[model samples]
Target: MLEARDTVEHEIWWEIKGGTSNVWYENWTKLGALNYVVPTDYPINEELVDVSDLIEGGAWNDQLLHQSFPADIAEHIKSEIYIDQLQGNWDRPWWMLTSTGRYTVNSAWNMLRHRDHEDSDFKQLCIKGVPFKIYFLLWRVLKGRIPTDDVLMKMKIPIASKCYCCSIPQQETIQHLFLTGQFATDVWQVFKNAVGIHMNLTQMKQVRYPCLKNAPFLWNELIDFLEGYKPILVSKIVYWNLPYDGWYKCNSDGASRGNPGPSSYGFCVRNCHGDLVYTECKELGINTSMVAKAMALKKGLMYCFENDLQPLIMETDSLIMKNVVEGIWECPWSIVAEVDIIKKLKARCNVLILHVYREGNSLAYFLTNLAFYFAGTSRFNSFVDLPSAGKRIINMDKQQIPNIRIRNAKNTSGMDIFT
Candidate 1:
């Protein structure tokens, strides 16, 4: 009985007369009714079954209801037996503009109005710390304002509207460029590999609707990843500061020659006043970046446990490690073993994982890189002093000297991003 241009939110009901409305196709009851006809092997007299055929004297024909439909759906029909009580068995229309079973023109008009609110993801893109250029580009991308080939052609541009990134003749639409282009797909794969997120990059191109729909989430994660590594302006070298009151700070880093080649992990523990409590470095055989980072975190936690350092705050330049440790994301199978140990260590001690810029973590970075000079693992006890380079970096951090400047790149793929 419902007939409106936009009737998705509207509700329909029927007053029983001669049972003319088809029980299956017709919107004869509230949403809780059997809205769609469930096919079964039972025979029916016609394509449409009216309400009367399923009703008996003052009640539902239980045998017929059971024979004609599944149990759950039959029970739903049985619950609406009050429909048989219409005065004099006369049929009429019942409209439901409001969920409270009241119909009003004003309510109907309001329901038909377009929504006036931005998606939560859009609000995230507009957060204060985000660069204006990056924010604007993401906003445009979400609104389909980017200059894809189809949009360019519509604007009368002379260039052919074909995919250039993939070197394919396929028309370059927004979906094709971001979600299907071969080059774009390959870049995404590299990014996923480098970051160690537990998702298949190929699925971005394989699954059309879901991949494009979650683009905002993917962008948000990328921005977060970049935030951990964004370089700050190097003015004067500063010394590393200690953790806040009642917490010990541990800075950790991982170094690899060829990513999957020989690698090492290092961590330095400092008191609240930037005094070095201890430091340790381990030489790990061939392993991926993900494994190395995970090991570094695990090593730092172990150092704290061995030294009885409680309520520790661990800092690392690897966003992937921090995210995985904090349960923000998943780790790949290769690094799951390390992550599991890290989790157990974290649970044992009052541990907090923080992601910092590499510039701020120079001492840990140095120690990790320094492992390259030594053939075996190295450990410095409380009585020992840090080597010259490590001491120099620590001094710089304590001085609050800027070691690097963070800057946004002109464009990443088709969008501006911080580099």
Candidate 2:
């Protein structure tokens, strides 16, 4: 088992959070043990024992870090190895081998069995109903481990490399033999026409594995797929409706760069005239998009209450959140406490939470995305203070310009329409 020390180190990673992880003892830095990376002269602050000591109010304390460590190390901690600083949980060991961060026999076996590892491209090859042979073939293709002409030539075999698939006598490289050759081009052309995808596929490095899995290998299956998904415009019911007089509407949205990763939320209070009253966008450290959404709504409610902006209608794009609030769906156990807080806030005011489509809630979405551009939470009280694009969206909404949501023609629900 000692032979697997390198493998074990490669597989397990410390997910940094507010609590549990010791600053010096744990492998949270990914550079190996934290003690080794520390400067010899720099004194480790006694107060900085836990990871939480490094964090402050959902962000890394930039000032404290620069004072505590060498400038480069402090920068790395606040930038590269940084979490959002409010993970709401203790630091834990995450299995790098699995998506769920949990260890499993199959994952362990795969790590041990595979001599050559590819850049996660082989993951798409393990499709449901796909054969193991296809999976193996694609895995080799991605890893460049297959005995192609170029690969075989590298093995010191005295042989000339030539492409038999194409009329041009190009060198039989992996890209030429499998992708750019005439026969391969013909095969792809057939699917390109069938799928109606208006994109170039020649970029070798930019291949998305999901597209490869979805593209039909069998011609007969391709025919059925095209037949099922013909081109047609489907009407989707989505638009911002004016709130009743003496009432204000709050629109909130939350999103993440990756689910349960770097996240943020935005919310706004708007009057019946479609004018923005107050808006705020903020980062939420590391959390799921669901948590971010819940936090957005919660913060929006809190803001309204604090400002005495009452009789509010809350609009969110998250359907699950709407259902959870209305008791129509099970609240995610992670966010049950948050949901309860929202419930109490709802009781405090005339709040009606409703689900809105992305098109209808474009302004909130735009606001939510603003967190990515700025360092911290940003606030807007006047329309002029908003970004130009945001102001345009507001103007469009006030002028009753419709936002369309695309749906399947087979399942059209007539509401908003444009030819």
Supply every candidate's count of residue pairs whose N, Cα or C atoms clash at under 3 angstroms: 17, 1
Model 2 lDDT per residue over 1-419, tens place: 67876556556656664466777766676555556678777787777788778777877888998877778777767654534335567766766566455778787877888757555655667889998898888778888988888998889998888888788788888888779888888888889778665364423212543322344545577556645754456656567888889899999999988897999999988998999999999987788898899889888988998788878899999998999888898765445545766887788788889888889898899999998889877999999999999999899988888886876444234433433
RMSD of 2: 10.4
RMSD of 1: 24.8
**Per-model CA lDDT versus the true structure:** 0.69, 0.77
User: Which lDDT tens digits does candidate 1 get at residues 190-294?
Assistant: 887786653744344235333232233465674554456432232333334567897799999997889779898888898776777888887777866677777
**Stretches > 4 Å off in candidate 2:** 1-230, 410-419
TM-score quality measure for candidate 2: 0.50
Quote the lDDT for 60 in model 1.
77
What TM-score goes with each of the models? Answer: 0.42, 0.50
Candidate number with greatest lDDT: 2
